[model samples]
Target chain A: MELHDKIRILADAAKYDVSCSSSGSNRENKNGGIGNASFYGICHSWSDDGRCISLLKILFTNVCIYDCSYCVNRCSNDIERALFTPDELADLTINFYRRNYIEGLFLSSAVYKSPDYTMELLIRTVKKLREDYNFNGYIHLKAIPGADINLIRLAGLYADRMSVNIELPSEKSLKLLAPQKTKESIIKPMSFIHSKLLEKSESKKLMRHTDKFVPAGQTTQLIIGATPESDRTILKLSENLYKYYDLKRVYYSAYIPVFNGNNLLGVSSPPLLREHRLYQADWLLRYYNFKADELLTEEELNFDVLLDPKINWAMKNLNLFPVEVNTADYNMLLRVPGIGLRTAKRIVKARKAANLNYDSLKKLGVVLKRAKYFITCNGKYYGGCEIETNKIKNKLLPKSNVLEGQLSIFDSIYKTESNLPILV
Target chain B: MVNYIFDGTFDGLMTVIYVSYYNRQIPNDILSENSYQKNFLGDDIYISTDINKSDKVQNAITTKISKEALKNIYYVYLSELESSYMLIYKYVRLGFKIGRKINYFLQNDIVNDVIKLSQRINHEAYKMIELIRFKEIKKGLFYAKIHPDYNVLPLIVPHFAERFQDQYFVIHDVKRNLSAVYDKKSWIITDIPPEITLITKEEEDFENLWKIYYKSISIEERKNLRLQRQHMPKKYWDMLTEKQ
Candidate 1:
């Protein structure tokens, strides 16, 4: 088959992975090397679904042995199959990088023939790209489950990032969907990469120049809505993975049903809004110093689709609101729904010079429409209405999902003369 | 109210700040020489581009504030906003008064405005570095065109130069009629005359392949054109290979 045909089939097979971020490590071009990695990864293009495309994400082959129900390339599924030789893959990556088509390569594959064989082909392809081609660009390689530990470690040295996807969140789902694969087969490689990364960092302190092992660190993806796992369960697992493994990121790929025949899958895919809410809650867990238990409960299986997780949390904890912004600590300021990390830092710095009023807070990039109810400036409450839950909810909810131009209760009462664009 | 007119250059902007501080009066407005507004009421001063005076002001910023702040001020000048000159003038005056402590005053409108302008410029430059698509026009020569919201051609070339060190490429900012030409050894920014067309036979083939791959990778079940446009705005649509 032609190379273009292979790219279409292989790229189509690989699109479901959805972990195309090429960031978190900085590698300069060597004297003879052709490319480098920036700390802030660049999005080369946006795919139609709005996800950033940072790498040439493709699978080595779409042919598979295991019959995972959620997978597009399962053995039972009939899809066009193609494979790229190590040389063709390496050359395609270099050619694309030269034309500035991608930051690097995201190489994944189904278990073609066997796990070990598929992993061997992947290793050969990446090793050729790095050593033979003198390619110094970012390479995110997948660690095939049940592959040799030595092979995983060796691939880590050449790749900038590595991931062993826990495709299903729980062991029960792994058993139900993919009987051939066990949870241990997936997690063993993850622990191996985690230990190797730890060793590399420790050795770097002692020795001036130690070989880099997955310099951008590791990440994994979990398929949401495929199985009947609650949001609380998913987030709890993610928090543990972050705390224990020191993983860089845990991506949540919303399940898109490919095979219609299976009774095990849903008739229609889950709402994208659910996926978006999970991302917001995940951000709070990662950056805003919120714990999993704080944000979730057994009664509330999932986040409210209408309200964001931060606002939901704030509304639940109203006593925390009406906190004086002039005297609030950085943590307290961060908890306000509208103040981001940048705005909180700005408020901290600006408040030292002058006591910030509502106008000053807006100038500092705070979303005053949401923040005014929660905060007080200089012992004065600018929020007109008494603190009430349903009233605040009515004020914050979009007039309709179609258009976000809903006038809040405050907007109806007072209108500003200046027509400066609101950042929010 | 005093009005200061300056050449559209960073050095000229710095010279205006130096002259304003030396004269000991806050100008009501600073206008670029190219601006259309003619005001007969205020005293209008045409400030010549003085390198020595500009250098003195630049040095004071480095000593009083920081090198990073000076670099940001330069980026703000690249914004080409009409009010940027006066805003920057007011900002530097405050910087000199507060010395190094001026960095902490985020509440001040002048300080915050300068920071916001630089952020806007930097964001556009970063987006251009990602969205730029180079087509192979000759054996070893590649070319791409863009129309970024900010004048970010000066900022993007260094990144592309370092990334594609052994090749020659030209990145044209079509809106500004400016192009950064990069040879294997070095790069130089130059003006491109009208009626220049850059195309190649093989370029179409590559573009078709890229568009195919772009389409194939997107999940049909999760198509969100609005979200796509939010990240890759409509203004940059024409220059993109896939979009074209």
Candidate 2:
């Protein structure tokens, strides 16, 4: 097949992987190559489905001997199968790159013959992009689960970021859903790569010289609403991975029901709303200072279908809030139902200038309908219809799936930091 | 009995603040050429375009507010705001009176709005790295250009410097002829007359390659044009390496 034909087929197959942030790397362009990875931040792109497409997300090949039940490209599926040689992919990347189509390449694969064969093809493609083409753009290589550690490490040097997906949360789930893969194959490489990143970080600390080692750090993905894994199990596992491996991100792909036959997941798609709630909860865990135990339990397999995670937490722990804004610490402010990072900082900064009243707080970006019930504005109550809980329920809309306005070309061209546009 | 007028520069803004501190309750307005038309006849209107007065006002801010607040004040002034934006100037000045013990103003919508403006400028400049696609010119210099909303041409420099450490490159904020040039080791912001800069045949060569790549990578099944444009807008195509 022509190279263009291969890219069309392979990019479609590869789009599902979803980890394309070219962030956290600080590599610069060398003698003849173009592009570099800056450490401060990287550009991120989101598909209409809201998945980030910051890199040239593609697969080397979709041909698989090992059929993971959740995978769309599994062997039994009649979807087009394609593969790109190392040289062809590099050509396409450089071509797209010079055109300004994508930031870099995000190459993943199904087991093309075997783990080793697939791993070698991936490594060769990256090596060619770096060596033959001298292309220095961001390359996120997906580490095949059963690929040799040696192959993984070599590919690691050429790529800015690498990931080995621990697709199922547990070994039991892996056996039940993706029989061809095992926990050891996944964790062993994850552990190896995680340690190397740690080793590089420690060396840089001692040496005070910047050397590269997976500078974008490592990230992994988990398919939610697949098999029997509960929200409690998923988040607990996510927390452990972050704490243990020092992972940069743990992406939760809401299971899209596109598979059939003995494939594990049930129904058409994972509740996207539930997945969205989990992301908000995940944000709380990573940045907002919430813990796993604070949000979920074994019985609750998913977040409340009606209310968001934070709102549910606030109503359940009603005794904690009505906290004064003037005195509440950053943690307490972050815990407020309607408050986000920008708003929390605003509350902290503005409190320095004047006493916060209900009006002032409203101006600061707190969602008063929800936050008002839980907070006191200068020791005065505002929320709740009659100081009776259920009466206030009518006021706060539960889980409003605010369909975001379509991101216009102009908006993306000049998008500001808040992830919102001034014109919009 | 006087209203002070300034040239709309940050320094000009500070001069007004300096005079206001000395002469309380002065019915004054800060006006830029972009907004100001006629001057009032009766009141003593002092055009304090003097750099020294601007200095005095700025020094007072540093003393009254933290150095951080002074920076905020300067940035808000950079908003290139209309004359009615005086409310922000007053709000920011009030911010100093409250000091570090008073973070409540961070939540003040006016203060937040200005901060967001500075942040947007910074963010747009930074994003030009990933989003500002470049073409290899015939002269062999890798060149990319952008027309971002804020003054991001300055903001995107250190990034291109650290990453493309040993390459010859130019990232021009085409809106302003200011371009960032990296010559192997360091970078310099240079003024270029973009209207006159000749784009050569190599751009055509690279342009065709980029289009082929752009078309090849897109999958029709997930071809969400709205989403594609959401991340890479069409207006940018006028300057992109691959828009055709």
Candidate 3:
């Protein structure tokens, strides 16, 4: 097949794996290297779906041996299959980087022939890019499940980041949809990468400036709404992954329906809002020191689509609010509905110099509309009239369809002072 | 009311600040040369670009306040806002009076304005870094043209230089008629002709692939053009290969 045809087929197949970030790694270009990774990722363009096109996210091939029901390129699907030669893929990446079309390559593949075979092809392409082409850019290689540990280790040295998709939330869901992929196959690589990363850090302590091993760390993706997994279950699983595997990110891809009548997966497509709320809750967990149980419970299986996860938590725990803005510590300030990581830090720094008022807080980047109800300035409350939960909820929730304006799907990127979203 | 005129350069603005500080007089307005308007009743003072005076003022700011404060001042100056000259003058005056603690006085209109102006400039520079797409022209030279709201050429050049160390590239600020050229080893800022066209025969194939990838990646069920425009604004569509 022609190169353009191959790119279209492979890239289209890989688009479902929505991990389009090229950040969090600080890989500099060597003397004769062609590119470098930006600590804060750069967005080359926005897709029509309003998603960032950061890395040149494409699969090495779309031919699969495993028949995962939720996937587009499953074995049963009679889709056109195409693969890129190692040299061809490397040359394309260099040309694309030279034209400033992408940050780097995000190469994944279906289980074509076998897991080890697919992984070997991926390792060959990346090695060619890194060693032969002298490309020092950010590469996020998806580690093939059930692939050899040695193969993964060698691939990790060249790639900045690696991921293994925990496609479904639960073991039951995995068995029901993807029989070929066991929970063990997915978790084993994650555990191995975690240990290797720990070993790398320990060696670095012994000898300063040690060798690299997945310097950006490992990330995983869970297909939300494909199975009957609650938000609580997903968050709990994600928390454990963060604690145990030291994963950089747990990407939640809103399950988009490829096959209309697939009885295995009931839902046509997961509401993008649900995926968005999970991302918000994910951010709160990572940055705001919030636990998964605090965000949701088995009773409250899903997040409120109308309100953000943080604001919902704030509404439930109103007693914590009316915290003194001037006296509140950084963590407490962060709990406020509108106060993000950057704004909270700014308030802390700005308050050291002078006593802060509502206006000063606004100047420091706090969203007064939401924060005012939760905070007090100099023993004065600007939140106004009878601090009732219903009133506050009404104020916080939009009077009209708030999602129309607010539901940008990628609001986490634009709204949070942090440029890179939680997915990165 | 007295109006002070400057040469529209950062050094000239600093010289104006120096003159105002030494003379102990607050001008009603400080205007860049192109922005200065003659008024029959108001007194006018045209400050020349004195490098020594500007250097002294720069040193004073660096020594007394902080390097961060100086950076903020420079960012605010690059904004070229309608009231930037006077606003920066007031901010500098306040800084000199309060020493290093002027940033804490967010209640002061001048201090708040300066901070906000610098934030705006920084936001623009960040956008420029993300949205500036280089097109490969003839002889493997990558050329990117940007018309940023703020003068962010100096701010974004360092990022490109470090990233594209092995490749020849030019990031041209078309609105300002200035170009930053990087030739693998080093880079220099120089003036360029307004209508320079450089395109390779094979560039179209790469652009087509990018556009194809962009279109294929978007999930049609969740199409939101409004949100896309918020980050990758419509003003930058012409320069983007995928958009083309």
Best-fitting candidate, scored by TM-score: 3
lDDT, candidate 1, A301-391, per-residue tens: 8887677788888888998788898999999888888787778888899888887877778888787787888888888887778888988
List, residue by residue over B1-244, the lDDT tens digit for candidate 2: 4455567656777766666666665455656654566655646454556799877766766676666666655555544556334755665566666655433455556566656665655555555655676666636467777887655565567766655554567888777678888787788888864232466775665456444544544433333455456565666556654444
Pairs clashing within candidate 3: none
C-alpha lDDT of all candidate models, in order: 0.81, 0.68, 0.82
Report candidate 3's interface RMSD in Å: 2.8
Candidate 3 or 2, higher DockQ: 3
Model 3 per-residue lDDT tens digits across residues A1-424: 8988998898888888878778788899887678898877777777777777778899999988888888888878887899889888888888888877788999999888888999999999999988888889989999999999999999999999999999999999999999989999999998999999999988988997877888888899988877888899999999999988888888888777766447554675445777777887888888889999999987887887777788788888988878998899999988887788877877887787788877778778777787788888998999885577899887766643333322242342432211222221
Candidate 3 on B138-203: residue-level lDDT in tens?
666788999998898999898888888878889888898889998888888888653346576688
Error of 3 at A249 (Å): 1.0
B9-62, model 1: which lDDT tens digit per residue? Answer: 888988998888899878888888997477787789989999999999999999
Superposed on all Cα atoms, the candidates' RMSDs to the truth, in angstroms, are 5.4, 5.4, 3.1
DockQ comparisons of all candidates to the true complex: 0.54, 0.30, 0.58
Model 1 ranges with Cα > 4 A deviation? A398-424, B1-3, B23-28, B35-45, B192-198
CAPRI-style grade of the A/B interface in model 3: medium
Candidate 2: which docking quality band? acceptable
Docking class of predicted structure 1? medium
Q: What is the lDDT of residue B182 in candidate 1?
A: 84
lDDT of 1: 0.81
- Is 1 or 2 the stronger prediction by DockQ? 1
